[model samples]
Target: MLSKVVRTIARPFDERFNLTNRLHESLLDKPVPDHARRYYFCFGGIAFFLFLTQAITGVLLTMYYVPSQDQAYSSVFYISNYVNYGWLLRSIHNWGAQLMVVFVMLHMLRVYITASYKHPREFNWVVGMLLLMTTMAFTLTGYLLPWDQKAYWGSTVTISLVEKVPFFGKSMANIIMGGDKLGQATLTRFFSAHIMVLPAGLVLFMAAHFWMVRKQGISGPL
Candidate 1:
């Protein structure tokens, strides 16, 4: 009876997607080299996991967060002090952003140190760098949502640096600021970027990164 139930659950997926054979070829039949068994080699996977965690937690946070000059700090305080387990979620989101960036950097360093970007893997290397930059942007955009002293000052300094760019500096600063200055417009733009544009970019690049890795095969030992 149990065997029959298992077969019934598997049949539709088998017919529609060739799930069994694909799984066999992609997982069981694929050889993962022994060199990849090391702890140092797993940072990319860790960063990807944290990115998923950020998506989930960020969605939950938007329920209580308000992106505005007058209310942003208040909302964050309310979440931290009043909502149940909101503090934990906020902490996870904060440290998760930092850790994700760290892991991606470590992963990139490992690849470069091992010369894993040779030949066919060079494109994946480029995609990986984009992913790292995307992670950094996520951190930067999310930093100002709290509207705290630290967030405000940090964002100001960063945007000020943007204004130092040669020909396009003022234009880029205005676009990011969403106005002549950093206020409600800036908060709204950052919020939109943190939740929408950056995640979409991450998804597309991540898909390419995985596909390239599979196609080129994982880098062998140095």
Candidate 2:
């Protein structure tokens, strides 16, 4: 009965737009080689799964999070202590982010070891690198949102390192932190980047990466 209802609802769209064929081609018809079916080959999918997990939990965190230097710590405390299940959500988001970085590294290493980055797949390699960098940026920015002592000292050290980078380094660091110091401005900047800019960039790069993979298919064994 449930399946009948679904088909009935989908029938007009399927007939008018050829939805069934397109769905089959996109999802069901792709072929995978035997070697690429190995356990190690699953890293990229695991990384993507972690990314989805982080996104869902991150959105939930943002609902109760106050992104101010003054209230940030208090808000996080409230979430953990006052809001039901908020602690679990925040924990999952934090750990999922860390694991995403690990899996992305493993996926890139697998690609390099398999010689999958050569020739026509070079552009995809660049995209993967960008994705890695973006993930790092997400971690860095999110680190400061809690506005604790560790976050404070860590961001200060990072900004100091940024200032040491050759020409325009000091200026670039200022632009990112919004001043010479880590205060309310720095919190706002990091929070904005964490929730807004970095997510958009990640989505854009991920779409390109997936499209390329579908077009090129997975490369064969070494």
Candidate 3:
């Protein structure tokens, strides 16, 4: 009786979309390398999982976060102290960001050590490099959202380094800060990039990376 009900519900969609076969082909039938069963080779997947963790927790954080000079710190404080399980969520997000970076670096290292970025996989290597940069941007932007003294000064100090990049350095720094100095506009810009721009870029790069992997069939054992 239950099987009949499921079949009845699935039949139309199956006829229209062939969802069952597609899922079996894409998911169940996909071949994973034997090395991928090991922990070290699994760093990329771990980092990807952490990215999802950050996305979920970040969206929740955004619900109460204020992107303004005046209210940012207060909003974070409220979330930490007042909201139910907000502290736990924030903690997980924070740790997840840190671990994501660590795992991404480790993944890159494993790829490099295994020489998996050769020849046909070189473009995918470039994509992975971009992913690493995007991950760093995520961390840097989220750093200032708390609006604490440490976050403010850390961001200021870090952005200052961009001013050393030759002719366009100062200009780039101004654009990032949204002015000659950091203020409400800076916070808003960072928040926008954190929640929107970076995520979009990450998704695009990941899709391309996965496509290439599917096409190229992951590097052989070595």
Candidate 4:
């Protein structure tokens, strides 16, 4: 079964190689069209650029952050007051996250209004929806890392909403908060989810999204 699956994957690679060779032979002398003036193309690119900025700044902030209930807030304060350019890094990360979410939403809106989600691009649209959810998850998990009163109460409200789910609501909230109540375990879990798990998932989905865009080619204006 594994061999069959490997062959299935390798077949496309073989076909791609042959197609590339043929393209090199046939289109080497052709000149591509200049579409630099188009703003739609630029919008997606700008969105991706902002996401990259968020990833970089988020990593830097992680180096100094301590997620414990006792130290989390103080550590963030230390980063802000003591570490050189820490304020700038934290500010960029916070603002960049907001900007990334906005740009991603706008990019999806553009694709939707133009009917780019039709036919072959449907899966890419689905991947994009997952990306949007992941972005919001990242924001929510990170909201509690500072361990401030606002962070604590904000998370309390959010978790209460989660606990309102019908059948498995209480259990699910317990699993998420790491116990029956929010405490050190909850902070640790949120820290890991925010910094590690969600980022990894987002990267995977983003890669798939880009691969599909390349495969189907960009949708043209209607």
* Candidate whose lDDT is highest: 3
In what order do the candidates fall by TM-score, top score first? Answer: 2, 3, 1, 4
The lDDT per prediction is: 0.92, 0.93, 0.93, 0.86
Query: How does each model score on TM-score?
Result: 0.91, 0.94, 0.92, 0.82
lDDT of 2 by residue, 15-74 (tens): 999998999988888778888989889999999999999989998999999998779999
Writing each residue's lDDT as its tens digit, candidate 1 over 38-148 gives: 998898889899999999999999999988889999999999999999999999999999899889999999999989988878889889889988888898999999999
Q: Which of 3 and 4 is the better model by lDDT?
A: 3
lDDT of 4 by residue, 1-222 (tens): 998897788779768687656767664644333543467656677877887888898888888999888899999999999999999999998898888788888888888887889998889989989999998998899889989999999999999999999999999999999998889999999999988899899889989998887676677657
* Residue 184 CA displacement from its true place in model 4, Å: 0.8
Cand. 4 TM to true fold: 0.82
Cα distance off (Å), candidate 3, residue 87: 0.1
Worst 10 residues of 3 by lDDT: 30-39
CA lDDT, candidate 1, residue 115? 93
Model 3, TM vs. native: 0.92
Deviation (Å) of 108 in candidate 3: 0.2
Candidate 2 vs candidate 4: the TM-score winner is 2
Of 1 and 3, the candidate ahead on lDDT is: 3
Candidate closest to the true structure, highest TM-score:
2
Predict model 2's lDDT versus the native.
0.93
